[model samples]
Target: MASFGIIGSKGRMGQALASAVEEAGHTLAGGVDAGELPGPLALQADVLIDFSAPAALEANLKVARVAGVPILIGTTGLDDTNFAAIKDAAKAIPVLQTGNTSLGVTLLSALVKQAAERLGDDWDIEVLEMHHRHKVDAPSGTAKLLGEAAARGRGVYLEEKMESGRHGQTGARKSGDIGFATLRGGSVAGDHSVIFAGEQERLTLSHSAENRTIFARGAVRGAEWLIGKPQGRYTMEDVLDL
Candidate 1:
């Protein structure tokens, strides 16, 4: 059994991960809260699971690299700089990063990719997501994940084709660009949908998260799968072999 170290020990996801680790018959190496250092815990772990804030990602990767341990990052709201840091860290240690860790979401991404591939640019793509009121970021990571999948199918990058928060005299929606709409209210765990609009019809793929445990359980499963891997970046798709 792997010793899994949690980087956000006091949060809801952290608590759920602790329970998940035990349920999976794995050992908990230790954990760190927002202000605590994870270096010592990393040294003791076979793998590290991070659900902490985006700002702490670089430091967490450094400690994981120093300890020569693999890490699975489920933290969202990351910027380009954070991605650059992750890419660098992957050169030295195995790193698995994803917006949503739920296995169902992974499958949803694959389905979205396949649909986008089969339906061409003629069918416009749009993504919608809703989360708890406390979530600070617009367009939840899962929406981006699905958008990226769609973009990949269309042989493009999400960064270049993404459109969000359009207001005022936005004359017309671009032909092939992917758009996103975000909703915030109540205590929603998570909800995401991707719509493909054609001439007179629409096809939508969606996933709803009922609890944080789904993410935690999936993360623990992915973290266990990350053990003894070569230095490289990975995703939930790799862990699920989708």
Candidate 2:
């Protein structure tokens, strides 16, 4: 079995990842939190799983690259530069980043793409997501990913034309615009829905996380799967073989 190391080992998601790694019968290489990357990081395992904060992403990735360890990164709200750094690092070592690690969410993306294709542009597409209040990021990375799926279905770039929400004086919903709405409340682990709206009927695809461990389990699974792949940037889709 491949060995595993977990960054952000003290947080709920980090603890969950550690537990999942053990439950999967993999050796625990080591665990580190918001400090200098430990020397042991280089020796601990075949893969490192980073579920840390956005502020620490650069350092975490630096450690991974310096250690020559392939990694699975689960942090969200990465800006364009951060994502660019990840893609650049993948040229030397395998690196994976995902908004949601749940296998179901990956499948949900595929289904949303198919739905968007079949429904055509006349049907409006919208993404609604909710997460714990403590979670940063307004629209949630999953919402953007879902919106991308819809955008791909409709053959448009989400960055150029997507709408987040509407207020007073807003006219009718624009055709070909994928809308996004966000809610932050309670301790919701994570929830996302992709809705296709038409005049009278609508279709929705949704997933709700009951606990944080679901993400941890999937992250560990992703680390295990990534360890043997050729050096490249990847997503949960690759991990799930979707």
Candidate 3:
């Protein structure tokens, strides 16, 4: 069984991950959260799973690298600079990072890509996502991911054509632009939809997480899949073979 260490031990997702790891017949080496990074994390487990905040990610990743342990990072809210650090760390250890961990979400991304490609840029792509009230990022990482998939399908850079929702009489939607809409409410686990709006037809691809355990399970699965892999960055799409 895989020996696992969780980086965000006290948070909701962290607790869920710990439980899932144990339930999956894996050993929980230890956990680190906030100011509590546990002692010698690298010696305690074969792999590390990070569901912590952006501030804690780099430190935990460094710990993983020094120990030669692979890491599966699930935290969101990291900007390009922080992401660059992750890429740097991947030089020595296998790292798997994902915006969302639900296997269904990765499959939805694939389907969205196919739809965007088949339907062509003539179809406007719009991403709608909703998460729990505590989620910190607007447009959620999942929203940006869906937009990226659409952008990739259209063979364009995401920044050049993606429109993250507009307000105040935004006029008509721009052509070939991928739009994003976000909503936060109650304790929603997650919900994402990709709408391809074209003349006389509309195609919507969506995934809803009824329980956060889906993410926890995926993270554990990813950690198990990452053991002993060569140094590189990977995604859940790789995990699920999408």
Candidate 4:
């Protein structure tokens, strides 16, 4: 069994991941929070799993790189700067990152891609997501991931086609534009829906996460899979073989 090290040890997702690691019969190398240094845990673990804040990404990557260990990044709300750091670190060690690490979400992305490819632009695509009230980011990272899948199916870039938060007097919805809506409230674990709206018919694909354990289990599975993998960037799709 692999030894797992956790970042953000005190947070909700971090605690869930710790439990998952134990349930999977793996060793808990140790954990580090925002104010803690990751060097000690990084040195002891076979692989590192990060569910910390975006602000802590660079420091965590440094520890993983120095320790020569593979890492699975589950932190959301990351910006381009964080992604650049991850890409750099992947050159020296295996790195798997995802917005949502649930097996259901991984499969759902594949289904969304197929649906987007089969449906013509006449079918307007819209993505909607809702998370816990404490979530800091808008549109949620999973929404962006689903949008990327849709864009890939359509042979377009998400940046060009994504339309988020329409306001008053916003002109009619543009053809082929992928829209996004977000809601934040209560203790929602996570919820996502992709709608293909076409004349006289509509198709909606959705997944609702009842709790964080699904993601925690997926993260542990990913960390285990990353062991012995070649240095490169990967995703939940690779971990789940989707």
Candidate 5:
């Protein structure tokens, strides 16, 4: 079993990952939070799991590179600069990043891609997501991921086709455009649904997260899979072979 180190040690996801590591019969090398230095923990781990904030990504990746350990990043709300950093880090060490680490979500992404391809652009595609009120990001990273999948199937780029946060006087839904709606409240772990609205019939593919354990378990599994991988960027689909 591999020894796993957590980069967001004190957070909810980090604590859940700790439990999952033990449940998977793996060793918890150690963990470090925002203020704590991660270099020591990175050196102690066979693999590293990062569920920390976006701002911490560069530092965590630096430590992972120094330690020469593979890392799985589950943090969301990342922008272009963060992605560029991840790409740079992947040149030196294995780096797997995803908005959600749940196995169900991985499979759901594949299904959404297939459906979007078969349904054609005639069907208006809209992605809806809801998270706990404490969640800071809107439309969620998962929603963006699903949108990308839909765009891929339609042979379009998500950046150009995505419509988010429709307000008053917005024109009618445009065909071939992927729309997104976000909801925040309660203690919802997570919920995502992709709606394909057609003339007569409609189809929806969705997944609900009951707790953080699923994400934690998936992160551990991903870490195990990434242990000896070559320097490169990867995704949950690679870990799950979806």
Candidate 6:
């Protein structure tokens, strides 16, 4: 069994990851959070799974690099700096960063891409996502993941063609642009829908996360898959190929 170390041990996802490791018959090397350093845990683990805050990402990658172990990053709302660090660290050890870890979401992204490719741009694409009230980021990472998939299918970049958080005076929806709408409330795990609206018809691809276990389970499986890989970056898409 592989030894797994968690970087954000106090958070909900962290606790879930710990349980997932146990359920998957893997050893929990240990965990650290906030002020605690990840060095010791990194040393003990065969692989590291980071669900920590964006600010802690660099330090976590550092420890994993020094420990010579692969790392699976499940953190959300990362910035460009965090991504650059991940790229640099990945040169020394395997790294997997994903917006959403649920296998169903991953597959849904693929289907969205396929649908976007087959449909004409005359169909407006709008992404909708809802999460728990406590979630800090808007539009949710999974929404962006699905939007990016649509962008890829259309041979365009998400940031360039995306519009979100519409308020007053938004006028008309651009033809080639993808839109995003976010909702927050209650204890909903996650709900994501990608809509392709045409003149007379509409197609929607969606996924509902009933519980956090699905993500934790998929993350545990991803951590297992990252071990023994050559130094590089990976994603949930790679998990799909497996």
Better of 1 and 6 by lDDT: 1
lDDT of 6: 0.93
lDDT winner, 2 or 6: 6
TM-score of each: 0.98, 0.95, 0.97, 0.98, 0.98, 0.98
lDDT tens digits by residue: candidate 1, 1-242:
78999999889999999999999999999899788999899989999999999999999999999999999999999999999999999999999999999999999999999999999688999999999999988888889999999999999999999999799999899999999999999999999999999999999999999999999999998998899999999999999898
The lowest-lDDT stretch of 10 consecutive residues in candidate 6 is: 233-242
Compute the lDDT for candidate 4: 0.94
Clashes of 6: 0
Q: What are the runs in model 3 whose C-alpha is more than 4 Å off?
A: none
Badly placed stretches (over 4 Å) of model 5 are: none
> Distance from true position, residue 36, model 3, in Å?
2.2
Task: Note each model's CA RMSD in angstroms.
Answer: 0.8, 1.4, 1.1, 0.8, 0.7, 0.9
Model 2 Cα lDDT, one tens digit per residue, 47-148: 988877878877777777888889898888889888888988899889989888888888899899889888867898889999988987879888888888
Best lDDT among the predictions, by candidate number: 1
By the TM-score metric, which is better: model 3 or model 6? 6
Regions more than 4 Å wrong, model 6: none
Model 4 residue 180 lDDT score? 98
- Give the RMSD in angstroms, all C-alphas superposed, for model 4: 0.8
Cα lDDT of model 4 by residue, 21-136, tens digit: 99999999989998889999998999999999999999999999999999999888999999999999999999999988998999999999999999998999999999999999
Better candidate by lDDT, 2 or 5: 5
lDDT of 6 at 140: 86
Residue 61, candidate 6: Cα error in Å is 0.8
